[model samples]
Target: MDKGKNKWAVLVGCNYPNTKYTLHGCINDVQAMRDLLVKKFGFDPKNINLLTDKPGSFILPTGANIMKALNRIVDQAQSGDVLYFHYSGHGTLIDKPFLPFSKEEAIVPIDFNLITNVDFRHLVNKLPKGVTFTVLSDSCHSGGLIDKEKEQIGPSNNHLHGDSSISCSKPKAIPYESVLTHLSSLSNINTTDIGTHLLEVFGADASLRFRLPHVELEFYKALKQDEGILLSGCQADETSADVISEKGEAFGAFSNAVQQVFKENSGPLTNAEVVSIARKILANQQFEQHPCLYCSDENAAATFLPQSATAASSST
Candidate 1:
C-alpha cells in the first residue's frame, strides 16, 4: 500500500430480476465485497460507488450507467491512486466474425446490453502511470476480461485437483443461443446463428460499430500503454456458480472464496497465492470453476491489494 495514494472503488452487481437469466447471488456478492473493503481494506465509504439492481438503489447496473460510473472513477483518478472495479454478474463472449474462432469477452448488464473486453482495455489505457486498477469479476468467461494482460495464474500453470483442462487459455464467448435468448426477440431476424447475424449488422469490428445504443465506436477504440490485474471467477469457458452456502446465504463462489481467504489469512499473500488458494477452496467445495489471476509477472508478485504498507500491515 502507498500511504499517499487515494483509494477508490466502483462495485456493480446485477441480479437481473424477472428475467430468464436472473442471478441469485450477484447483489449479495457486491454487498459482501463492499463490507470487506470498508472494514478490512480501509476504503472511504464516500469514495466507493455502488451500482446494483436492488430497489431504491442510487443507480441501476445498466451498461450505460456502469460506463458512467466507471468514467467518473477514471476521471478523478491520479497518479498513485488505487482504483478498484468489482463486478458480480453474468458474463458472455462475442464471436469475432473476421477472425476464425476468435471471441471477445463481455460482462452482461441488467438490461441485457454488454460491456465488452475491448471497452475494458480502452478504460485501462486511460489510467495514469502509477495508478493501479484491480478488477475482480465474478462471471462466466471472465478469465481474459482485461484484453491483452498476461495470465500469471491459470490452467496452463495450475495443476489443481489434477485437472489441466479447466481453463480455455483464450477468450470464450457464451453461446450465441444464450445471448439471443437473453436479448429476447432480435426483431425480424429469424436465423438461429446470432453471431453471424450480429456480424452482418455490427461489422466484424465490434468496437468500431455503433449498432447498439449507448455504444460509441471511437470511445471504445481508445487504448493506453498500461495494464491492470484481473481476478476472474473462472476460466474462459467455465460457468461460475451462484450457490447457496451451507449457511443458506446466496453468494458467488469466487467472491465467497476470496473474502473467506482474506478473512482467514492474517498474513500478506501475493496475487498468485491468492488465486491458488481460491482455486483449491472452490475445488474442495466440489466446484468445477477455477479462479484465475491475470496481470504481468511483476504485478503478480506485488501485494494482493494496492493499499499503503502500513494499512496493509494493519489489516493483517
Candidate 2:
C-alpha cells in the first residue's frame, strides 16, 4: 500500500452475453480501455487483468466468472495500486426494501440480484487501504439507477421530463462540492460524502437505526490520499446514459466518450482533459447522452494506447 511504489489494475466490461441482460459496448470499450492502460500507461500484461462475460480467445470473463476473478485480485490489492472499476450496461434500482442493507455498503455492479445495500458495503470494505479506487458507472439509475417508470417531458421550460422542456440555456457546471452540500442537507443522520449520501437515498435500511454501521470498507478516508477518484456519468439528479455511437456501436455516451478519449490522446492526459474531451463528444453525440466525470484528485491523469497496438500486445 505504498503510494510511491508501482501500481496495478482490474478491468471489467460485459457485452454479448448469452442472456438478454447483455449490453452493446461494455465488452468492446473495456477491451479498448485495457489496451490503453497497457501500451500507453505501460502496465504489464501480467499485472493488468481483464474481466468480461464474452468467451473467446481473450481475457474476457462472465458475471460469475468475474466474481471468481475478483477473488484472485482483491486480496493482493495493496495501497497506492490504482483499482479502476468500470461498468457499461443496464442499471436499475431495486425498490424492494425487504433486502437488508448496511450504511457502509452499496451494490454497484452490472448484473445484481439479491444484492442489497449491505452487500455493497461488504465488498468495498475489503479494499486495501491506500489502494486508489476509481469507479465509473454508465447505466440506467436510481442508486436510484432506474427511473422506476418512464418520464414524459412536457414542452414547458419548467417541465423536465420530455416535452417538458428544461432550462433552454446551456446547463452550467455546478461545483461538485455544491452538489455534495445539497446532498448533505437531505439526510440528517450519519453525515457522509456524495457517494454515501446517494446510496442512502434508497440506502438498504429504511429505519436509519445505527448512526454508523460496522461495514468493513477500506474506508475511503483510510486511503483518501492514495489517488482515489470516481467519475460518474451523470449526477444524482440525472440518468447516466443509453445510446449508440458514430461507429454504429450500441454504447452509453459515457463509454463511447471514454473510448474516444483513449483514441485521441497519444500521451498522458489529466483527468480534466478526459472530462473535457468526453463532454465535447457528448455535445455532438447523435443522442442526448452527455457523459461526465467526477474526481477527488486534482492532478490525477491517464495515458491511452491505440487499438491495433494494444491488441497486438495482448495477442503476444
Q: Against the unseen true structure, what C-alpha lDDT does each candidate score?
A: 0.73, 0.46
In TM-score terms, candidate 2 sits at: 0.56
Writing each residue's lDDT as its tens digit, candidate 2 over 1-316 gives 2131344566766553564344556667677766766665556677667766666636544334444454455567775555555665544333232234522112233333112233323334566765555555565442321111111111111212222112221111223344345546665545544446655553542212122344422131233332334454654445555444344655556766777776775544555576666666655543343444433333334322212344445434
Which residue pairs overlap in candidate 1's backbone?
A: 1-307, 1-308, 1-309, 2-308, 93-173, 93-174, 125-224
Model 1, residue 25: C-alpha shift (Å)? 1.2
Give the per-residue lDDT digits (tens) of candidate 1, residues 145-243: 788788787774343454222221212234556876644464346765454344444353333222444345445543443548899998875778777
RMSD to the native, candidate 1?
5.5
Cα lDDT of model 2 overall? 0.46
- For model 1, the stretches where C-alpha displacement exceeds 4 angstroms are 1-4, 156-174, 181-225, 309-316
Question: Per-prediction TM-score, please?
Answer: 0.82, 0.56
- TM value for model 1: 0.82
Task: Give model 2 RMSD, 1 decimal.
Answer: 11.9
Q: Weakest 10 consecutive residues, lDDT, candidate 2?
A: 146-155
